[model samples]
Target: MEQHSPSIRAQAVALMRQGVPNRVVAERLNIPRGTIGWWRSEDRKACGETYEQPTDCPRCTTRDFDESAYAYLLGLYLGDGHIISKRKQHHLSISCNAPQIGLVAAAEDAMRKVMPLPSVSQRHRSGCTEVKSYTRHWTCLFPQHAPGKKHERRIALEPWQQEIVDTHPWEFIRGLIHSDGCRITNWTTRMVAGERKRYEYPRYFFTNKSDDIRKLFTDTLDKVGVGWTTLARGSDPFNISVARKASVALMDTHVGPKH
Candidate 1:
């Protein structure tokens, strides 16, 4: 590192003590930003000050953000995402199938769009990739996060969140499908005239163990004029099926299969 004169260091520290940001002080003094940051850290330590990283969280800062992205993220969270807000560990994690690299990129993009200040990373595990954003303020944006598993607890959206979902229902549905839903086709052979004809039925299915989440999904489908039905898997009514021709077409046009 290039050395700076004591006088220059003193001036930088003085400006920083007066609440001028490190970037401003660095530019004003023509010092490297990293050196300015070091000086500020040293000054704070000498004065017994604790440093707090700056954040651009939408809920905490009350700043306008990409609501379309946020609506999609909300669906992802409610479907299969989770937040860890422990004192030493804080982050939001969205798991994506390892083969679906597009969904991984989309998840990371949504996180950055909502809160760009925090760092984001992807961790590969088994057959999935976990996209994570490090920041405790995630709780502020995802107030629905709480103790216990999501399915074991009640999940409801805030009014503001509902408004965003109402505005961008398709994006929200896409997020949900990307996280916990899939597109499937069931085909059968039938006798037509004198020959066997193959008939294929394409449908979309969203499976989540949470009743409230399934309700939210169905409610959004209703808002978007898509018909859905609940199918019981043995005994658990945890599948939302969109098999109607019109509904399937609408889903294909908007959500489609996870890529």
Candidate 2:
């Protein structure tokens, strides 16, 4: 038995391109046929980046953005990386803090303009709405994200159940404020991971807002009945502080304006 040093998949792929049969590929390598096929797929992925990579990066070519591909990406972005049993056939269900229908609409519109043959929804079977659902994947053509380019990911944050965030300027800003509390994207600023998980602050992201703008941001928080705090706890358990103590109190007491 002549042993090979590299991965069996690489060896198998080399053999496959050489016109080897599954049985021969299996027996010659002493590996399973199914494993050979799986390796072939893995090899294909190595050639292309994941769906989350910057779209049209040339190097990161994705499968055509059809219904099936959209379903997988939707699961990656809006769902829990798993498709619901109920919607395996027709529609893909997604959840996120809905952004502006206008923004989403604009994206949809842009996608349509680019591919005029099929409407995005008709061709891709994707529909956007207002609803907030929790998931690990962020929905944007550029999911992993690039700085100054982070806005690319905002479309994924659009929620359907509640009013879409796209229409409200303050809501959008609030989201920016909320997201800013997290870690700095290494693309734009020097990022320092916290000593522990969740010990890291939720970076407070902003798009070049000045001091007066920040004050207006706090004012918006007050007006919207949303409380926020962005202080560091020198030695606190959570290791961070919240500034909008009063708004949180109002929210807790259920004592403010309603949408």
Candidate 3:
């Protein structure tokens, strides 16, 4: 048979039928890639038959799929630079969490021996593309948090981390605040000057998923690099009130520019 792309195309299609990429077939057939893509289109034109799948992907339209292409795609999605295009695969899927994506991008980057934090581009998926991302649970960088033990592991979120979280609220995103010199249990529970008791604690409130109220916590502790620790039991109410009052006072003062 002629070794033109048409012939190569037939062989390539046969190989692809068993599932193989163009680059691999190109390597196997010892054919220049121009021929790989060229003859197929030509043959399809002549025969009035086309195997090309119409992808709705607007951003990725110019590119076809294969090993190198898939690698480029995965790299692109994971934020690789060799391909000068949109690096973020920021799929609307809630599957992959922030940490997992970061870790995977980091690892794949290392394996490919490419630079970390690749450059991206302006293209977008104009049509619907159905790619799935792996989901991950939120990982506390503090790594000390066990189930229901968030209080014991108070890892101060750095300003950069807070900023990243702010940019991508899709992360295990939250705003954080810290308290200092707190006696969670021992506090004066006296309204007058006589009978009083200091006791256990109630609850610990950390920032979760609120944006407007986010800065209310993060900004309050921006420059304050210090930390505090106190153990509070469930029996303490008044002390908790005092603590909250302290927090409120500080927040009102710091949160002010209007007040």
Which candidate number maximizes lDDT? Answer: 1
Candidate 3 lDDT by residue in tens digits, 1-259: 4456555568876775566755687799887766666655665677787574433231233432222222222212221111111233222111112333343343233223322122221222433122222111112112222333223334354463444444433112111222111223334464446756655443223322223223333343333321212324464311112235554344334221110
- Candidate 1 off by > 4 Å: 1-39, 47-50
Instruction: Name the candidate, 1 or 3, with the larger TM-score value.
Output: 1
TM-score of each: 0.86, 0.20, 0.25
Clash count in backbone of candidate 3 = 4
The TM-score that candidate 1 achieves is 0.86
Residue pairs in steric clash, candidate 3?
85-121, 95-135, 200-236, 201-233
Q: Taking the tens digit of each residue's C-alpha lDDT, what string does model 2 give over 1-259?
A: 3454567667788887686766789899888778776666676587673433123321134534333222223222221111222221212222222343433343344333322332134222244342222222222332323233322233222242122322343433333332222223122334357433323222232321223334434444555665555443453222222324454444334321111
Residue-pair clashes per candidate: 0, 27, 4
Lowest lDDT block of 10, candidate 1? 82-91
* Cα error of candidate 2 at position 57, Å: 24
Worst 10 residues of 3 by lDDT: 172-181
Candidate 1, residue 152: how far the Cα is off, in Å: 0.6
Q: Report the Cα lDDT for residue 154, model 3.
A: 44
Q: Rank the candidates by TM-score, best first.
A: 1, 3, 2
Give candidate 2 misplaced runs (Cα > 4 Å).
1-170, 182-213, 225-246, 249-259
Worst ten in a row by lDDT for model 2: 79-88
Encode model 1's per-residue lDDT on 100-208: one tens digit a residue: 9989999999999998888899999999999999988898889998899999999898998889999999999999998889999999999999999999999999999
